[model samples]
Target: MRESSSSFPPHNNTSNAIHKFWNTIKCCSSSSTSASFLFISLFICTLFFTQWSHYIYFPHSTSTTNSLQFSNWTTLSNNNISHDYPKKDGYVLNCSSSKALTITCPPNYPPSNRNHKNFPSNQTCPDYFRWIHEDLKPWKKEGITREMVESLKEKAHFRLVIVNGTAYVKEYMKAYQTRDVFTYWGVLQVLKLYPGALPDLDLVFQCHDKPSIMKKQYRGWRAFVFGSRDPPPQFHYCGGDSTFDIVFPDWSFWGWPEVNVKPWVPLEKDLAEGNTMKNWTSREPFAFWKGNLRNGPRPKLAKCNSVNKWNAQIIDQDWIKESREGFKDSDLSKQCVHRYKIYMEGNAWSVSEKYILACDSMSLLIDPKYYDFFTRSLVPMKHYWPVNTMRLCKSINFAINWGNNNTKKAQEIGKEGSKYIFEQIKIENVYDYMFHVLNEYAKLLKYKPTIPEGAVELCSDRFACSPMGLETTYKIETMVNGPSEQGPCELPPSYEPLTLKSIHDQNAKIKEQVLAWEKENYGWSWWTWW
Candidate 1:
């Protein structure tokens, strides 16, 4: 209006400028929409990238991690291989579980019942030579029975797999040669009992005492069995564990091989063939115990002889060769001469329990705090008498008095214990138990049996190879000649019961502390609150 343009009217110029301003605003709004779209696209791409990275980094697994420390081991199966087969990983393992590991006993064998009181009163030994000779057909042909294959159809199928890792075989050979005669024969007897089954890739047999505590070092494929049983402390294995899962009771616990060459023999024959002559009435009316007093409560029990009477005779017996007059010191066969026999714990579980019970004498058990594979199954007062160790001497005396007063009842208890042992704990039963355990352990393997690195080969057949190497032979000779000695045990100063005064004193101290604390807090209550 102040300066008019010549080209067009002033109103026309104003209209054009307004149109330009409106277009500029529309362009700005479109730019803002594009910016929001860009941000949203970037966020989605980042989220996908993060998710993909997480998926790639984490491990996908379904098996329980607690069973073993390491996992993701691969298992490969070979269908064509037969018995004496080498592990797929190239390690040589002997008879392993052909199937999955199970807790039940083998075919036709009955699971032991602890509560069953009525057992066979007169079970006798089978023909031992015939049993082995017909079955194993070992190189020693003297015992061989020329029985046809049809004869073995009734028995369970068994395989003898000897896992021979260089180091493991060396360790096994060492134990086999150095262990007691019972251990040596007992281990070999398993092989002797069963005909060799074709070795399956899934099976493996490890030769070592695989204590539960050593599970950390164990690989999942290996199974361990031994001549002794010590269940893990406060831990029970229902089916399988980290190390070896199956623990059959030691065969030596039933009978020792040095005592009898035959693999299968009755408990009566194993202990003393003449034991039947000395029944409860014919035996002396006294409690008898003869064992080493080096460890456990043996020394205390020996000291209790001070409280002895005509009814009990507990003597300290150092069982070493030097302590004995000849090859026979206390003839074990003569042990049944006494009406009552005592059961005591030694370094671990004693091997004498079965032999003692087989004597048909009332076993005055020293209230065992530890148990082997089957000891806990025996009922107290039914199979044997329990003696509380708090007043050890008094308990023993009381048990003996009860036995003397109740002769018929005591004899019944003795016979019942003998019956239980005979029915449940034969060598045949031992082999059956082993077969089940091995079968169960095979199923738990994470991989097919493989030879460990640096391990040596062990022959599956005992007859094919020598029992010991030159070095081991030398070592055994040295051990035989060496002085027999036992390491000292950490024994308590006294086995006497705690007095009532001690208990009262502990309670009084607790009461005094409480009273003092109350007095101190209550004394300054008002001032402290302020």
Candidate 2:
């Protein structure tokens, strides 16, 4: 050390220290081994220092870009992030050590506001839409034209009552069984629509057993009745020309909710949209009809089906047997799979018009003698392809043949029909019509009503009268207007009436057979009594 200090002629101390460190490394390992290790260590140190220097100098870009590469790490940076979060498939993954419950709601569902108060506050009956008597059904343009509401206002009185006592109820029931009365459904419909009307009047509903109206007065007939049924020309025995003031549709076109029956067709919402048949050519080419063969021309209609050009399926539905085997109701919505659909009358006016027309399939409608509240508006070959009763089978064949050939026009007709019905005849709209009719009738009351003996008091709040199930089959005693005879009404020429002689003859035979059966079982006295 003393010799170095004299010989080193005042060199800097820092440089001397570095030179000594280098020489120490060389001496520890052989030259090749030491040099290779030393180069790797120095290169690693250089890379690390360079990266650290970039992070510090370009802090925002370098740090954020690298840190965000891990999604979990980024999520951890969020303050309110849930540990047990829902996955993309709607299931929650529990990430917590302690047990905690997590519920995932459907996408876009609003937070529950179940307890919030309604904006309008109290809702009342008067606040809803209603149909009027003057707004006639489309098919009855010429028929039922007399303004019933105005007529009632000029010459009617309101009487509502409940008939109690087992004897009186039984007496009315006897009348109903004998077909001397026929307004059960109509009366019930009115009550449901207007429970507050004539709350205290006592009256009964009566009509001829069959759909008949004649000049002959009814025997044992009360001066006042709640209502009567059947239209002119067809039902000559109705005898409602003068005595009955109220005339409601035989049964509502829509279903009764308490009864649990839905509309004749599938609900509009459940059905596929109009013109949904993408390839109409692939559908069953022939027309189709499936229903009970009990009414005017259905039996003859069954004879009309053919394998030739007028292709169709005409089945005679046995509803009774079908019920016994547990009703296997057809999927009405699937019926549109057929290219053509047929519409025919049942016993009287069926609620099927709306259903048949609503299907996207072209409707081959048979000429109907009777019209309901809404059929007048549709034009032939427009809403439906009309089939004549005069040449029953021929007309059906021709219509279907024409439809098959002119497919584009036929599809247009189907689409139009479905659109028209869906817009006009909803269940809610049907109730609106009931409300208006009842409201108008109430305005014509001659006397303020009071609850009668053995009668349950009803306001608009009640759905039906007391003895609900039992009374469905019995005569309901209520109030009515004093009887006054009106002359018979004449039907329009466009009815295209069918000769019901065969049907009448058949009914006569059945009546004769019934009388004979009674005579054999209970003697001549029972026959005479019946």
Candidate 1 lDDT tens digits, 1-530 = 01111121122334464566456556555556777768755765554433322111101122322121111111111212122211233112232321211111133111111211122123232222112211111112322121311122222121122432110111111222112222323333333233232122222122222223344432333323332222221111111223322234543442322222122242345455646667678888878887677665677787666424535677776434522233244446566777788888764456578777877899988756444444534766678876656556656666677788899989988888887777766645554444333433333333445443322222222111122222212212211111112211111122123533554355446434533443453363556322
Q: Write the per-residue lDDT of candidate 2 for residues 409-466, one digit (tens) a residue.
A: 9889887888767776654344444434434443433444334233222221111121
TM-score of each: 0.47, 0.45
Native-referenced Cα lDDT, model 2: 0.41
The number of the candidate with the highest TM-score is 1
Clashes of each: 15, 30
Off by over 4 Å in 1: 1-177, 180-188, 196-246, 251-267, 270-272, 321-325, 453-530
